[model samples]
Target: MNKTFKIYAVIFIVVMVILALLEVNKKEVTDWRKNFDTNEKSPFGLFIFDHEAKDLFKNKLKKIDQTPYNYYNTHKKESHNILVVETEVDTESWNKILDQVSNGSDAMLIVSQIPKEVSDSIGYYDSEISFADENVLKLTDKKYKNDFIKLDKFPSGRGFSYIKPQVEILGKTVEKNNSDQANFIKIKFGKGNIYVHCEPLFMTNYYLLKSGNIKYAQDVFSYLDDKETIWFVESNAKVSRFFMRFILSNPALKYAWWVLLGGLVLFVFFNAKRKQRIVPVIEPLKNTSVDFVKSIGNLYLQEGDFHDMMAKKAQYFLNKVRLDFLIDTQNLDDEFAKKLQLKTGKTIEMINEAINLIKKAQDPYAHVMKEDLARMNKLLDEILK
Candidate 1:
């Protein structure tokens, strides 16, 4: 096989091997499909505490045991109170539900990490909550003057304060906006209320089992009391928002996507044919004697080396002429000289001069005078003519 084909074959084999290995590794993962969970799991496959928090919520609120939404819809005889915990709140589905609770007869309680984008879209008021004697403004237009509760000191040092249970906040509270101590917030919007925990780690399976934060988690959800709550365990809306922002912000990424699409188009355009390969016929090589002689003659002319080259040519022509014309070189003073004189109708002096010039011209180094070399070439040409 040719070198290119061998290299391509090796590369193809290696790529296939790598892909196979990756597929096997992917299959080895316990919960690969759960990678997209917003709160329950992170991108790196680590299960965040939010999943455990959801389970704890399910166990604590017996009414929402089967499904949070189902329980919310079915619990109509009593006060239609609902609770929602989410990583982000932006989807129209979530908004529609919130609107229903706010405008309808139900009272809703929502616990979530409200992304800034969603907060901005809904036009919520901004407020900051502070720790270590620092003041934090609330996001809502309406303000609440209250003492800050130290989260580190709660439930045997694992619990934090719930603040005033029902308050209005216009702007959203984010985990990044507040200090590490700023873990949770409670907001009242329209007729529904929201309780957001910035860091959901305390509610995770691992932390709940070990850190004794289960009591705090229970307290956070139990505020709904006997009210049915909808626990929407969905992916973070912010991730999608962030991705949209990135695509909109980076012109190069947009161009790169276009370039990739163009390449795919070209690939499809070129490889549409399904033709078979045809064997090529090889031809035999021929000798190049005539070509070599002509090339040498051209080289000699271009270099103006006529005196030296023509001496060789003249010698060859003289040998052939003598043989063909049946002239005897021996005794050239009589027989050969007379025959040469008759054949060319040239003077004996000129023929003799030609012979002497050919001998002298054979050696280029012997010709010191430029005029002698020129005369020699002229005489040789005349003899050949």
Candidate 2:
């Protein structure tokens, strides 16, 4: 069993070492789509190096690390316009944002898709843009109306299909004069306006790096130039803040953690048995009294010592008579015989007979026969009764 356990241990160690080596050498590619974080590698991520929008806000861009609703309620009196980029809005946050925007502060939402509740609340719909060839985007702004820029690639996803009649169009696709497929719209609320843009990836790494593309994004932000502070929501990228999140995020580390937990449980279950104290083996005691008595009896029988046996029997009988009748057994005279007769309810002849046999057995020089011993035993038995 020990040898087998050692072999399994060696195999397990070898497998772990190989896995570690493979993981060390593995090159992992960062998935860049729909990850609109502040990191550089994400296609939609805002970085100071690439996207000019970061420079446009600069120190004025205050990122809300927590949920929008929390920030809004905490700083409700403060007038800060929200800048939501490539983020899915929850109902509660959406409602809060709507309330904040309707009261005084404005908001700009740049994403590939918007939630159904938000879209329904403000008469807006989305369209699926086909990825057959390069998508040509046209800015309907009077200043850049003639500048229709054609792109090799754009963010592949849904776009704003329709908007309310009261919504003012800012940008549209150059394919057709369909206002229904407009990419940008501005909806006026109670005291502020909501700027909605369909393609957030246009302002990301791929398109933002293109020639003249930065100016186009700049022009789009021109609508919100009046706002002093822009609250950039950073909820999606919040997981990067936790140390354990990194381990749980990786497939190898997560699996290893589960395996380690399982091994610990198994060790506790098996090693607990090994830690218990050993139970001692107990031997039963021997009843040697009967055996010793039987052996001594057999030794006398083999030697043919009828004299010794008769003497022992006569002495034991006398001892028993002395103890039971409370009489002196030293003398077996006629008076003793009468006392023995009255005590035992036996005849005088019987007592006399037993006394004569006992006297003969008591004689040291006398050679007693087996028949004499047997007659003495019978006479003693009757006298005792």
Candidate 3:
């Protein structure tokens, strides 16, 4: 599969596993109840509302209307319970709601995409922060100060306001504030609590079907187990804006750009500095004799000058016979012709006739008989033979 498909496949498998665990745990709880419909009509299938969670915690809670920030909002004033789950939430909305709940005795929990501003806000509200494994949670001991301070920090260091809760961090590599985790954090505001989870896959409808953290989900919304709870689910454009930030934060993209730059630099360096090798050049030989003869023949033929071509051929044959037999043209007798014939293995009459034909010139364009040209050609061939 292509890389993108593989990534999507991996995400799909992880979601399926979480949903499977949720489903399996769901079947085990015969007393499980559902109150709100999360899948009322969502295209992304990111948020899943638990009506059972609201029913189990009935009377003590109220599901709030989903603002332009939170994905799922459920509240329990009696139990001081407020649970917020979403892919992301706005800082202003979060702060306003936290301020409202902190004034009272309610607890708030938020799950969303993390921003530096949100992290700083969580730190502002909580006294103790601890990070362990890959999870971070902020705790405050305003109401139960004694119980909150005793929590141990991982690796025996001064813990931040947030503490790692349940998951073990040993042997697990934590990517430095990577966007892959979906930027999740939890904090306590006065008597209330707040949580921010980066990736919503852990709480999506597909994940709730088979999530292994049924107890965690229960604990998260546990205040609703005893009283009436409100389940509010929604999608906001503001929360989705954080997704763009998350995508741009990918380290792979940064590294890919760096690699391309490096490759371009190397290509320029090698091509610019390297010299091309020089080699000896050879001149090709030319054949002029055949070319010259063919040129003359073509020119004569184009002008319909057959007499000139036939006379040239006859003259060439006469020069060749004189050189081969030492023939004298001064004798002008059949004896010289006979000697030329005997030496060259040709008849005397053929030689004499070829000579006569070469010496005589006639009009080439005249309506000459075809038989005359044929006879001349036959005599020339015999003389050459």
Give the Å error, residue 20, model 2: 1.6
Q: What lDDT does model 1 reach?
A: 0.47
> What's the CA RMSD of model 3 in angstroms?
40.2
lDDT of 2 by residue, 138-163 (tens): 67878986555555654353456656
Q: Which candidate tops lDDT?
A: 2
- How many pairs of residues collide in each model? 19, 1, 54
Q: Which stretches in model 2 have alpha-carbon errors above 4 Å? A: 28-32, 48-54, 124-126, 146-151, 175-180, 235-385
Error of 3 at 40 (Å): 6.0
RMSD to truth, every model: 34.6, 41.1, 40.2
- Tens digits of per-residue lDDT, candidate 1, 232-290, equal 45434444323245765679987887797678555544544433589798887887999
Residue 172, model 3: lDDT of 13
On residues 1-385, what C-alpha lDDT tens digit does candidate 3 reach at each position?
A: 3454455556757986987777656543221122113543232243344445544465455555566244323332343444555424466666655664566434334333344555565553222222332342212223322211111112111122334453211111123452212123345556555554333333434334553434334444433234333333453333332223564567887677668767855555555555568977888788799999899767876887556656566566666767765776555466666666656677667778755565552344544333555567788677666
Highest TM-score against the true fold, candidate: 2
**Which 10 residues in a row give candidate 3 its minimum summed lDDT?**
148-157
